[model samples]
Target: MSDDGDDPGRAGTGEPAPAEVGAKWARDRRNRVFLRRALAGVLVVAVVVVLGFSVRTSRLTDESGAFGPDLAPVMDRIAAENAEVEKNHPGAYVTVVAMFPMTGSLTDIGLNRESIRHGLEGIHLAQVWRNRQPSSPPYVRLLVGSDGPDDWEPTVEAIKARTADEHIVAVTGLGASTGTTRRTVESLSGSGYAMVSAVITSDELTGVRGLARVAALNSEQARAGVVHARKVNPGLKAVVIKDLNPADSYVKTLARFYTGSLADRERVMELSFDSSTRFSGTVLDVIAERVCNSGANTVLYAGRSEQLPALMQALSQRDRCVRPGMTVITGDDASEMNRKADLNMWGDTRIRLFYTALAHPAGLTLPGGEVLTAIRARFAGDDPDAFPRVFPHESLGDGMAIVHHDAMFVALETVKAFAREPDVPSPQDMANMLTSGTVAVEGASGPIRIVEGGARQTKEIPILQLNPDGTSAYSGRITMTDGGPGRS
Candidate 1:
């Protein structure tokens, strides 16, 4: 047993005398393989754990319910009321779907959380307001939905699933002016559902049938900005700074509209940059140089609010233009910009930042604003039935609630108009009327009259003046078409 081998089994055999060395190497190789396997297993476990956690924490986009927990109770309350309507009068109530960005995109920069919340509140108030009316024939019920950032098919399908039972006549609170928004609108329109969007301002959303918008078209907004720029400066020579990102319809249409309108009646210069990447410094500096040397007193910025400060800084700290003061009017996206934190954009310059907003409470003082006068009263805690009862008063300033209320108001009114007809109106009937140039809705934003085929809309465009202290004041409102027609 103590011969010269590591083990007694191999000692007697003439097989190997270096059996101990071979055994040690064999053990070492086995240990190495075991260790590698163990490490690999641990790595796999770690990856699985991380993936599990990510999946658990990620937001579910296809909930087919309220996007936020705070919205659940309000929707539940509406649901209870809907049930009561069904019990009282089975076929009297029609469903209305409110689709806004409740889940997908949220950020801290511009009160996005508050925007969504208030928008929902506005929709709820519209439903309540319409039903509480004494002569209500076709009562309104609400179904709230939101789509994922990438896919909208599920949301559209969900809406379609409820069509038989819910009796959805029209959709309101349609979201922003992006491609997803267009697709959703198109899908719904093709389904014969009338749509009333709260805040879509793209010019390219034409040819879609039965789609109406409470917001002004990009062309109208451009005309407002240009007219204001002319009022600010009589000479009226202007430079346009725009985002060249092709994906965003808001900026593209804004840039196109601005340049087109400016070229028509005034002296115009154009400068642009692609904000899809991080070219804020280099490209903006060059744009600023041209602006400074152009002898133009006005800047029509057709870009998003996030990159506005960079452009402002670029325009600042440069050789002065011959013009005394600079009037800068941005697109509706500037409504989301932070005024206080972004006040440094002025930078000891004569730049006055003005933006065209879809809505403002101050516009209530304009012509035909008394319809929405209750918004002001209720925000002061006046009516328990109207807005600010569910939402905070501070949310009033952002105009999300106002616009949503207006949009829902448009859809509900359209449905009601058909409800009064001889035969019961289906969604197709509502769709026909929404673009028939016959329905005139007085929304909170102003008046919305969708022309034939729903190509355009006439509503008041609110111009908000950005103050030095990083707050905005309602300057004035521009009446599109003298309240003529068309919103899509």
Candidate 2:
């Protein structure tokens, strides 16, 4: 009777004794109290979570909704294509999870949602192409998994959970080159997944097991950028304006490599700023005063394009005592800047600005351009496969499509190269295949020559000049080999 843990049952047969009744009542009361506390705790947590993300989150839970409103059709197309590919190729198709920023501040910078749409569209085109290929067996099945750029740990776990059910062979299109991204790559790598990133450009990301990129590394871009900068600005006395955000791997490597690649006698005053500050407007103004006083003819801006306007504004309004027509060169983050920025609207004091392009449309001239042209034709419905059902041609201009296509192509090529018969290949098998030193992907950007070595896309890195007319002019092309920068 005193034992609350045991059953004091006999309710249907007869009335329980007073002690038994008291015991049952006490146990029931305790259970009710415990449940009530638990429910209250759960409610508290629910409110905290809602309040935490309410300001920042729009719809992170929706698979495609986070890409923005206009991209709903693109998401629908992906779903239809996903269904069609699995339907036609009725076998063990290998899955590749593309981890992109379905939600992030990428747009708060210079990037746009159309770029994300184009990337997914590119992946869809590749799926349709590969599934229909005569090569046969082991067609690709792409699963998108994004928990935003900053919070990828949860999605990594979710993807790991899906591996058995989804037959996931590899991961692709890893989002921005931040510390969070690096950790995700490392975690997925630890779990024996092959990760092919479309746009991860951190120099520090090299040599991580099962991690490869279809984009040029920051050092590669810097190496290529320096080759052009020296020729254009002869004296080349420069101020390196850099972002001090610890999480941003891209700008960190860009600043380091650009500084290292410069001539010993070429350095002037080096300036720094942390983009996280809301006070950038006033801060850049101070930096502008120092630049005017420093006698530097060029500004090697190692920051995202989000801060470009502030720098341009500050540079434009600076005292005319600074060397006129200063040249500003940056990394690949500037590739999409032209779409958001009105470069023509800036004052006359803002001179020439150059940035490295990861994969330019001009890459259509390369050997792989044959494949790119054929695939891109699908976007315009010029190809018989997509005729009268065109995806917008303008979406393909930003190179997201090309890089994302190349990322998927690299993953598929690894699968095809693995010598597997119509069965789900293990991620360890794909990881082994990638690191085996023979997986050369003929990327739409250019040939992705080295996956395991120091550089992934050791092909062409285009240097683009932001024009007064708000367009990018392909100023020059240089290649980055494991050996060094080479002629494209």
Residue-level error in angstroms, candidate 1, position 390 = 3.5
**Which candidate ranks first by lDDT, i.e. highest?**
2
The C-alpha RMSD in Å for every predicted model, in order, reads 24.7, 16.9
Candidate 1 deviant stretches above 4 angstroms: 1-66, 69-91, 103-111, 263-265, 319-323, 338-346, 366-381, 420-424, 455-457, 482-488
Candidate number with greatest TM-score: 2
- Tell me the whole-model lDDT of each prediction, alpha carbons only: 0.67, 0.68
Give the per-residue lDDT of model 2 (tens digit) for 1-488: 11011233446777554344434443543455456657866766888788864222322222455455677665666666667756764443567777766666863223456666667767766666666654434556666666466557778887776675456788887776876677788899898888777888887888888876778888878877777778787888888888897778888899998888888788886789888777866888799779877878778888887778778767766656334767778888876665644345356535778888887766665443433445445444456444224464444446787788777877887776543232346888888777767777555675565544524746677787876455676776887777379875
Q: For model 2, where is the 10-residue window of minimal lDDT? A: 1-10
lDDT of 2 at 150: 51
Predicted candidate 1 versus true structure: per-residue lDDT over 143-180, tens digit per residue: 76664455466677777765654567788876777667
TM-score of each: 0.76, 0.80
